[model samples]
Target chain A: MMAGSALRRLMAEYKQLTVNPPEGIIAGPINEDNFFEWEAFITGPEGTCFEGGIFPAKLVFPPDYPLSPPKMQFLCEMFHPNIYADGRVCISILHAPGDDPMGYETSAERWSPVQSVEKILLSVVSMLAEPNDESGANVDAAKMWREDREQFNKIAEEIVRKTLDLPPP
Target chain B: MADDASSSSGITGNTVENSINQDELIMKQQREIEKEISETIPLVGEIEELQTLEKEYNEDPIYLLKVKDLSSKYKSIRRTRPDGNCFFRAFSYAYLERLLTDKQEYDKFYEIAKNSKDILVALGFSQFTVEDFYETFMEVIQRVGEHAGSTPDLIETVRMELHDKFNKQGYSDYIVVYLRLITSGQLQTDQEFYQNFIEGPRTVTEFCRQEVEPMYKESDHIHIIALSNALKVCVRVKYMDRGEGSQVIAHDFPEGSTPLVHLLYRPGHYDILYA
Candidate 1:
C-alpha cells in the first residue's frame, strides 16, 4: 500500500524531470518496470576542476519515497570530500533532520517532501563545484582539498577524465 | 582497555566500511524501536476517561495534582502516537471529529482546505506533489462531512470511520504531511512576521525546510500559531507540567479567539481533550 503511493509520486517526478530537464542533470527510472531505482547523469559545473565531465549516479528510493530521502551514490569513481570512497553521496539534503550521520549544520537544507529529485541534483552540481570539507566522507580527499589546492585539483581533473573515459593528462 | 583496543582497530584498514556499518546499525536500531512503539500503540487511540491519566501519575503529587486540575475542565482524552507528528495528527483528528457535528465550521474548513493547494503552489511548492496530498486530505474531509448533518446514529458511524482512517498509516501520515505543508505555506506567506520568531541567521524558508517540512520533526509554539492563523481556527492548549502550579495553563493559539479545538500538552506530546 505504501509502495503504491511511492510509485505514483516517483512516476510524477519522472515525468516532471523529463518535461523540464534541469540544465545540468538528466535522470530517469533505470527500468520502466521498476520505478524504485533511477539513473542520473550530472554535468560537472563549469570553471571547476570537474568541468567537461559527465558524472553518473544511482538513486535507490525506499517504499516511502518523498517522506524519506533516497540513497544516492555516484556510479563512477569520485574523489570529493563529501563522496565516500565507495561512491555514496553525503550531502545534507540527502538526509532527514536529526539523522545526522555527518553532523550537517543546522542551517543546511534538509530532505523534506517539498524537495524534489531536481533539487538534489542541483545541490550535487554545486557540491561538485565547492566541496564542503567539514563533513568529509573521504578523509584523504578532504585533507588534500584543505592542505594542497593544486594536488586536489589534479586529482579532481583525473576523476573528471575518468568519468569521460579519457586518459589522465 | 577493550575500548582502547577497539578504537585502535577502528583506525586501520576499512575504517569507512566499519563506520558505515556502525551508522547502519544505529539507524536499524532506531527503526526497530519505532516499530515496537507502532505495534504497541495505535496512531490515534480510542477515547479514554481522564481518570486513566491519574493512574499513571498517581505516585507523583505534582502530576497527580495537574491531572486533577485537567480533569476538572476536560472529561476525556484521545491519545495519539507519541511519534514526532503527534501534534499535527492530534490536532487534525480532533478538529475533523468536531467537524463531524458542526456543519457551519465544517463548511468554513472545507473551503479553506479546498483553496490551500493553490496557496501552496503560489508559494513555490510543486503542484505535482502538493496535488496528491491535497486530494487525499479533501477526500477524508469530504467523507467525514458526508454525515455531518445526518442522524445521531449516522454521525456515530462516520465518527468510527474517522477513527479507522486516522489509525491507517498511509491516510493518517498524508494528512499530517498536508497540514505541515499548509503550516509551511503560512510561515512563508508571512515571512516578515514569522522571521522575528526564528533564532539565529536562518531565514523563514530555511526554518521551514529544516523544522516544518520534514516528517517526524516535532512542532513548537510557532508552528501552532501559524497553523491556527492559516486555517482561521483557534486552538487552546492546556500545558501540564511539573512547574510550580496546580492549574493547567490554557493558552489559545492566537491568544484571544475562542478555541474550537482543545488539546492537552505534556512535554513532547499532544492529545485531544473533550470538555
Candidate 2:
C-alpha cells in the first residue's frame, strides 16, 4: 500500500541526500530497485550565467511520496523561466497543492509534506540563480528573461557549454 | 503526477511519448487523490444541535440574522476534517474532547501526552518512527485516560480510535507528523518568543521547516500560536469572514484566555463549535 510508504520515504530522502551533500548538489538512484526514479546533478549556481555547469536532472517520486510533489526534469537543455520547454521543472515546490489548473500558484506557494529532496534541490539551485519571470513556464524563456539581457547571457552561456560537454555518467 | 513530465517540447523527446505522458499524469494524480480520500468528513461530528438559519440560508436575511445570533451564542458543531489538517484535526479532536470530562485537564494532558515521546525522542525522532507516533498518541490519551468515568465511553473510545488511526495512510502521516513534531519542538524551542511572531524573513527554524512539519500545511496565526502554546490548550478562533457587521469576531489565543477549543473560522475552514 502507498507503494510501501512511498518506498520508505524515498529511502529516507535517499539517506539524507547521501550523507549531506548540498554544495552544488548531486543526487542518487538511477536505480536501487528504483526509489521512484531520481537522478539530479545541478552545480551551476556559481557566479550565475551558470558558471561551470553540470545540470542533468530527473526526480519523479509520487506513488504518494511526501504526499505528492516531485517531478523535476531537465535531463539537460533547460532554458529557465520556470524550466519547461521540455525539461519540465515548473517550480512552486513542484506544484500539486490543488494541482494548480493554471491559477498560477497560491496554495501558500504549493506542495506540502514539508518538501524535501534537499528542499527540492535547494529550490533548484535557487531557481537557476533567480528566474521567476513572473509566471512564465518558458514563454521563450520568459521573453529571454525579460527582454534580452545580452541575449540572456548568450543563451545561459550556451546552456553552460552544453552542460560541461556531457559524457560523465 | 510523475511531476508533469511533458518533457515533450524541448526534446528528451519520445521515450514512448514520455511514458504516455507519465501515464496520464499518474491518472490525474490518482483521480485527485481518490477524490480526497472519498471525502473524509468526520472525526468528531454528530453534535449539530441547531441550524434553521432561515432554512440553512435561503439567501441572506442579513446572513440569516448572523446565523440566528450564532446559534444562540454557539451550541454545537464538532466537524474536524476538511483535510487541510482542519486546525490540527479540530485542535486534536477538541483537546481530546475536553480531556474527556476534565479530570484536571486529563491529568495535565496525560503528563505531557505521556512524555510526548521524550519530546519527539529528545527532538531527533526516528526512534522507531517517533516510537510509532508516540504510541498512537498514547493510545489516544490512554483511551481518554481510561474513560474518565464515561463521557460516553470517552467519546466512543476516541471516535473509534480516531477512525481507525486516521484512516491509516502511514498512520495518517504518523498522526499529523506527530502533531507536527510537537508543534515544531515547541516552536524551535521558543526562539525568542517566536521570533517576533514571524512576519517575514522566516526563522523559527524556517517556520518549523516550512509551515510546521508539513503534513497538510494550512493552519496560520503561526499555526494557531504554535498549536495553542504547544497544547496548553485554549483556542477560541471565531472569525467567519466577508466582514463588516454580523459581529462574530472573537479571537482568544492566550490573550485574555478562556481555553477549551471552539473554532469555526470560515475562511479556509476549521469547525468544532459547541457552546
Candidate 3:
C-alpha cells in the first residue's frame, strides 16, 4: 500500500527531472519497472577540486519515500570527508531528524516530505564542492583536507581523472 | 614501536566498528518499539469515556485529580498514536469529525483546504509533491463531508467511515503530512514573527525544515500556534503535566479565539477531547 504512493511520487519526480533537468545532474530509475532504485550522475561542481568529474551514485529509496530519505552511495571510487570509504554518502539532508549517525548540525537541511530528488542531488553537488569536515565519514580524508591542502587536492584530482578514464597526472 | 602503532590503529578501527554497531542496534530497537506500538494500538483509537484515563493513573494522586478535572469538562477522549505527528493527526481528526455535523463550517473549511495547495506552491514548495498530499487530504475531507445533514443513523455510518479511513495508514498519514505543509507554509509566510519564537540562530525556514516539516519530529507550542493560525481554527489545549496544579491548565492557541477543537496535551503527545 505504501509502495503505491511512493511509486507515484517517484514517477512524478522522474518526469520533472527529465523535463527540466538540472545542470550537470541526471537521475532516474535504473530500471523503468523499479522506481525505488535510481541511478544519478552528478557532474562535480566547477572550480572545485572535483571539477570536470562525473560521479555516479545510486539512491535506494524506502517504501515510504519522501517520508524517509533514500540511502545514497556512489558507485565509483570516492575520497572525500563526507563519503565513507565504501562510497556511501553521509550528508545531513539524507537523514531524518533524530536519526543522525554522523551528528549533523541542527541547522543542516534534513529530509522532509517536501524535499525531493532534485533537492537531494543539488545538496550532493554542494557537498562535493565543500565537504564538512566536522562530521567527517572518512577521518583520514578529513585530516588530510585540514592539514595537507596540496596532498588532498592531488588525491581529488587523481579521482577526478580516474572518473574520466584519463591517465593520472 | 612499529608493532605498537599497528596494534593501536587496529584498536581504533575496532572501536569505530563497535560504535557503528551500537548505533545501528539502538536504531533497530527503536524501530521494534515503534512496530510494537503500531501493531497494538490503532493509529487513532475509538472514542472512550474520559474516565478511562483515571485507570492509567490509579497509583498517582496528582494525575488522578487532574484527570478528574478534565473529566468534569470533557466527557470523552479519542487517542492518536504517540508518534511525533500526534499533534497534527489528533487536530485534523478532531476538526474533521466535528465538521461532520456542521455543514456551514465544513463548507468554509472546504474552500480553505481547496485553495491551500496554491498557497504552498506559491511559497516555493514543489508543486508535484504538494499536489499529491493536497489531493489525498481533500479526498478524505470530501468523503467525510458527504453525509453532512443526514439522518442520525446515516451520520453514524459516515462516522464509522471516517474512523475506518483514519485507521488506514495511508490516508491518516497523508492528512498529517498536508497539515504539516500548511503549517510550514504559514511559518514561512510569517517568517518575521515566527523567527522570534525559534531558539538559536536558525531562521524560520530553517526551523520549519528541521522541526515542523520532518515526520516523527514532535511538535511544540510554536507548531500549535502556527497551525491554528494557518487554518483559522481555534484550538484549546489542556496541558496535563505534573506541574503543581490540581487542575489541568488550559491554553488556547492564538491566545483569544473561541476554541473549535479541544485537545489533551501530555508532554510529548496530543489527543482529542470531546465535551
Candidate 4:
C-alpha cells in the first residue's frame, strides 16, 4: 500500500519539478523506468562559498517515500559542515520522524511524510548558503567553518572548482 | 538451504547464529507487543499495585522518593502509545473526559473544532490531507455525545475510535498529527503571548516549521500550552520524572487557570493521569 502511494507521490513531484523547476536545481530519475533513484544537479546558491558550481547529486527514495525521507548524496566531492566526507547531506529534515534522541534537533525540524523533494532541495540550497556548524556532520569542515573562515573558504572554493567539471552524461 | 548452511557451520556456530536471530526476532516481537499493549490497555497499572520500574536506577534516590510520593497523590494512569503523538493523544482523551461533565465547555470545544479546518488550511496544510482527520475528529466528538452518560462509557468509546487503528495512517496517527498542526498554528497566530516561552534561536515560524509540524516529534511544554490555548482549554502536566521534589510537579498551562485536561509527562513520553 505504501509502495503505491510512494510511487504516485514521486510521479507527482517529478511532474512539478519538470514543469516549474526551481532556480539552480534540476532533479529527475536517472532511468525512465525507475522512479526510486534520481539524479540531480544543483547550482551553488549565489553569495555562498559554493557559488558558481554545479554540484551533481543522487537521491535514493525508500519504498515508503515521504513517510521515510530519501538519502541525498553529492556525486561530486563536497567540503561542508553538514555534508559528510562521503557527500551525504546531513540536514535535520532528512532525519526520520521522531525526537532527536541525541537532543541535537527539535522534534519539528525532523522528517515527516508531508515534506516533498522540492522542500529538500530548497533546504539543501539554504544549507549550502549557511552551513549549520553547530551540528556538523563533517567535523573537520565544521571546525574550519567555526574557527578558520579563510581555510574553510579555500577548501570549499577548491571543491567548487572540481565540481564544475562535466561528468560524462 | 538456509538451514543447511547454518547447520554445516558446526553445532556451536549454528547455536550462536540461532541465538542471535532469536534475540533479534524477540526484540522485534517485543516492539509489536508493546504497540499492542498501548493500543489495548487503556490503563497500564495502578500506582501502588505496580512494582519498581525496570529502567530506574539507585543513583536516582530522589526520583524514587518522588515516584513514591507521586503514587500517593495520583492513583492511576491511562497509557497512550509512545509514538511521539502521545501529548495530543493524552490531551484529547483527558480533555474529552473532562468535557463529558460540562455541556457548556463541550459545546464550546465542538464549535471551535468544527471550524478549526479552515484555520489549518490557512496555515498551509493541504485540505485533502487534513480532511479525513478533521472529519474523523468531528465524528468521534459527535458520536461520543449521542448521549453523554458515565465517564467510563465515554472513555471506552473514545478509546475505541482513537485506537481504532482501522486506518493506522488516518485514524491512529493522522488525527493526532492534525491536532498538533492546529496547536502549532494557534501558537504562531498568537505569537505575542507565546513568544515569551519559545526558546532557542528559531523564530516562532521556524519553530512551528521544525518542531510542531512534524508528526511523531514529541510535544514539549510549549506544545502543551499552545494546544491548551488553541482549544481554549487549560492543561495540567504532571511531571513525574526524577526531579528535585517528592511531589510530582504540577504546572497549569496558561499559567494561572484551573485546568480541564491533565497529563503525566515522564521524560519523552506523555500519558493521562487521574486525580
Which candidate tops lDDT? 1
Cα lDDT tens digits for candidate 4, A1-169: 5566567778878987898899999999999799999999999998888898899999999986665789999999888988888889888888765323232444336776556788899999999998887664676788789899998888878878888664422
Candidate 2, position A41, lDDT: 90
Q: Which pairs of residues have clashing backbones in candidate 3? A: none
lDDT of each residue in B1-275, candidate 4, tens digit only: 99867666766645654565566567667766866765664322222222243135456777777767767766666666676777877777677666666767878888898889999788786554455557667876786565445467665675465445422553445457668778877987888887887886668877777777777667888887788778888888878775565787889987888887777788888877776
Docking class of 3: medium
**Residue pairs with backbone atoms closer than 3 Å in model 2 (clashes):** A71-B3
The residue-by-residue lDDT of candidate 1 on A33-69, one tens digit each, is 9999999999999999999999999999999878888
**Which regions of candidate 4 fall more than 4 Å away from where they truly are?**
A1-20, A28-37, A47-49, A62-68, A77-81, A96-115, A132-169, B1-75, B81-84, B96-110, B124-161, B166-170, B199-202, B215-218, B239-260, B266-268
Point out the worst 10-residue segment of candidate 4 chain A by lDDT. A98-107
Question: How is the predicted docking of candidate 1 categorized under the CAPRI scheme?
Answer: medium
Interface RMSD of 3: 2.0
Angstrom error at residue A164, model 3: 0.6
lDDT of 2 by residue, B1-275 (tens): 45445545456435644565566678779867855773765544556664733476778666666666678788777665666677877777667767777778788877876776787667665454455456656776676677754667556766677656655565555557678778887887788988898887767876776666656667788778876787777788888666777766778897787868888787787887888
Per-residue CA lDDT of model 1 for B27-142, tens digit only, reads 86897687587668889999999999999987999999999999889899999998789999999999998888899999999899999999999988989889778888999999
Chain B TM-scores, listed for every candidate in order, come to: 0.92, 0.30, 0.92, 0.73
- Checking candidate 4 for backbone clashes, the offending pairs are A108-B210, A108-B211, A109-B210
Q: After TM-score superposition, what is the CA distance of residue B149 in candidate 2 from its true location, in Å?
A: 4.6
lDDT of 3 at B201: 84
- Relative to the real complex, the DockQ score for model 4 comes to 0.17
